[model samples]
Target: MRKGRDSKCLGSIIFVLVFCFAISALPFASAIQRQKAKIEKHEFGELADGIALYTLTNRNGLEVQISNYGGAVVSVKTPDRAGRMADIVLGYDQPQSYADDTVFFGVLVGRYANRIAKGKFSLKGVEYQLAQNNPPNHLHGGVRGFNKVIWHPREVSRADGAALELSYVSKDGEEGYPGNLSVKVTYILTNANELRIEYSATTDKETIVNLTNHSYFNLAGAGSGSILQHVLRINASRFTPIDKTSIPTGELKMVKGTPFDFTRPTVIGSRIDQADEQLRFGKGYDHNFVLNKKGKELSFAAEVYEPKSGRVLEMWTTEPGVQLYTGNFLDNVHGKAGKFYNKRDAFCLEAQHFPDSPNKPSFPSPVLEPNQRYMQTTVYKFTVRGAGRGR
Candidate 1:
C-alpha cells in the first residue's frame, strides 16, 4: 500500500510539472508566431488593366504596401515610440490617382532618374532627344516613364522577411533612349526593420541609366502635417549647386556656410527660409548633395528624426549623390485618407548618380555598357529613438 501511494504521488507531481511547463511555453510560442513575416495581395483597382497591391509585413508588425501599377510604395506603416502604427509615406487612395500624380509620391523612377538637360544627351557621338516634360529639362525619364507604367511582380521567398520583386523592360526608343533595358527592382522588408531596395539592370546597347525611388516621407505619419520640425542630417560635405533652370551648375560647392549644410542634425525649418539663392531657386531644398563616400560601396547617406514620434530613419546607399527634395511643389495635393499635402509637407532622399550626368562630363558617369550590368542598393532602416535602451 505504501509503495502504491508513493508511485501515485510521483505520477501526480510529474503531471502537474508538465502542465506548468506547457503553460509557461505558451507566451514564447506566441512571440515566435508574431515574429513570422507575411505577405498579402489584393486587387488595387483597374488602371488600363487590373492592378495588384501587395502588403509585406515584417516580424515586428511593420507593414509596407506596394502596387504593381507603378511599382509604387503606396504605404509604409511603422510603430511610433508609443507602439502606435501609422502610415509614413504619402500617396493616393486609389491607383487611378497615382496616374495623375505629379509630385512623384512613392514611385520607382527610371531610364534617367533626374533631369537630363533640355532633354538632350550625346552618347558615342549619337545625340538623343527626349520629351521635355519639365520645360527645358526632361524630368524622371519622360512623359511616360517607369513610374507611369506597369511592372511584373513576383513574391520572393526570403528567410529574413517578405520580399517583392518587380521587373520592367524599357524598349529601345521607348523614351527616346537607345537601348532595350531590362530592369529588376526588389524590395525586401527584413526582420530587422529595414526596407532594402535592390536595383539591377542590363542593356542591349550602351545607354545612360540612373534609377531611384521617389518616396515622399513624413516620419510623423503621412498627412499629419509639415515636415519642418523633423531633424535631418546628410553625410555630405559638398553639394552640386543648381542653375536657375534647376540644372546642376557642375560646381561641387561646399555646404559649410550655405543653407544646404546638413552635416549635423538640424531642424529642417531652421535655415530653409533663409534668403539664400539656392532656397529661392528651388522654392526650397531641391538639389543633389554630393555624398561623402570613401568607395563604391554602400555607406550612410542621410538620417531623419521626428521628435514627437521619436521615430528615426537612416538611409544607406551605394549611389554617389542624394537629392534632398523638400516637396517644394506639393501645392496642397490630395493624398491618402482624405488628406491634403502642402508644400514642405514631406521630403525625398533620392539616391542616384548626379542629375544630368550624361550632359555633364565632369560629373560621375551614369553610362551602362552592353557587356556590363548596372546595380544599386539602398536601405532605409527604421527605428524608434532610445529603443531597447530601457527608455
Candidate 2:
C-alpha cells in the first residue's frame, strides 16, 4: 500500500519507546529495593534487657558495635600502627556494665562453648545435668550462659565495605540447652584493615553444641594494660591439657616442650614468664590449641602482634580448637573508655570446641544430632602492619 504503511508506522514507534523505558525503571527498581530495606532497618539495635545493638561502618574507618547482651562484642574500632582508632574489643561501657559478669568479657559463648566436664553429658541414652557453672564443671552455658543470656536482635545487613549482621534465638530449653538454636553473627570491615567474624548456627533437638566469641582483645587499647608485649601465633600442633578445675585432661598433649609452644611466632611475654606446669596449669595460657586444620575447612587459627599498636589480629576459623586466653584472671575490671581492667589486661582467642568436647570420647564430637546442623565460623582479621593509614 503506501510502502507497507510506512513500515507499520516505524514498528509502532519502536514499540512505544521500549514500553516507556521499562515503565520508567519501575520506580527506580522499587526505589532501590526500598532504599535497601531502609538501610537495613537502620542497622537495628533498640532494646534494653534482651539487649541489642548493631552498628557497622567500613571503608576502612572500621567501626563495629555488637551487643545482644551475650552475643557480645560491644565495640571495636580498628586502625592502629598510626592509622589510629582506639577501642579494640573489651567491654563494660553501660547497660549496667554487662549487668554482672564472671570472666567472659565480650560475650556470645554458648550452650557448649567450652568445658562440660562434671556438668555431665550422656546424650542418646539420656543423662544431662548442666548448669553447674564451672568448678563442678559446666562452664559456658550453665550459669545462665550464652555469655549470660539476652539475645533477640536479628537482621542488620551491609555486608561489604564494612559488614554488619547480628542475629540470635535460643529457645528449646533456653539455658538447660537442648536445641532451637538459630544464630548468625557477621561483622565484616574490610578494605584490608580487617575486623571480621562470621558464625551461623542451627539446631532442633539432640543438642550439645559449641559456639565462641569471648572477645577481650587489647590491641594496645581496651583498658590499656598487659598483653605481655603481644606477638602470639598458634597454628597448634596439639594441646588440650587442663586440670586444677580448668577441666580438659583427656590429654591430646604434645606442643613440644610445653608452655604450649605456639609453633613459631612466640613472645606473649616469652612463655608468659615460663614457670611451666602448663604455665601453672593455665593461670596464664588457658588451653585448647589443636587447630592444625582439618575437616570443615576455614583455616589459619591464630596470630596476634600488637608491638605498640601495629595491630594485626588475623585469627580465622572453622573451629577445631583455639582458646589461648591470656587475660589470666583479669581483675580490677573497668573497661570501655573508663578503662581500668587490670591483670593480664586482655587476650582471648577462643575459636573453640575442645575444653570438654562433651566429656572427651577421644575428643572431637560436639554431638548435635536430630537433623544434624551445628556449624561454626570465626574470623578476627583486623589489620595495619606498619605505618597504619586506614581511612
Task: Name the best candidate (by TM-score).
Answer: 1
What is the lDDT, from 0 to 100, of the residue 227 in candidate 2? 83
- For candidate 2, write residues 1-391 as lDDT tens digits: 9999999999999999999999998976775455321112232234353555666555435677776667677788876766678877788766556757787887878868777878888877877777776678787887776676666665554535445566677888776777688777766655555666777777877787888888888888888778888878789888888888888789888899766787888778766767677678677888888988779789888888887668888888888888888888877877666777877888889887888777678888888776766767777777767744321
Sequence-dependent TM-score of model 1: 0.92
- The residue pairs in collision within model 2 are 70-108, 163-188, 194-382, 195-382
lDDT of 2 at 220: 86
| Model 1 C-alpha lDDT per residue in residues 33-124, reported as the tens digit of each score | 86778889998977766589999998778999999888999999998999899999999889899999887889999899999899999998
Model 1 bad stretches (over 4 Å): 1-29, 387-391
**Cα displacement (Å) at residue 203, model 2:** 2.0
Model 1 RMSD to the real structure?
5.5
Score residue 319 of candidate 1 by CA lDDT.
Answer: 96
- lDDT (Cα, 0-100) at 231 in candidate 2: 78
Clashes of each: 0, 4
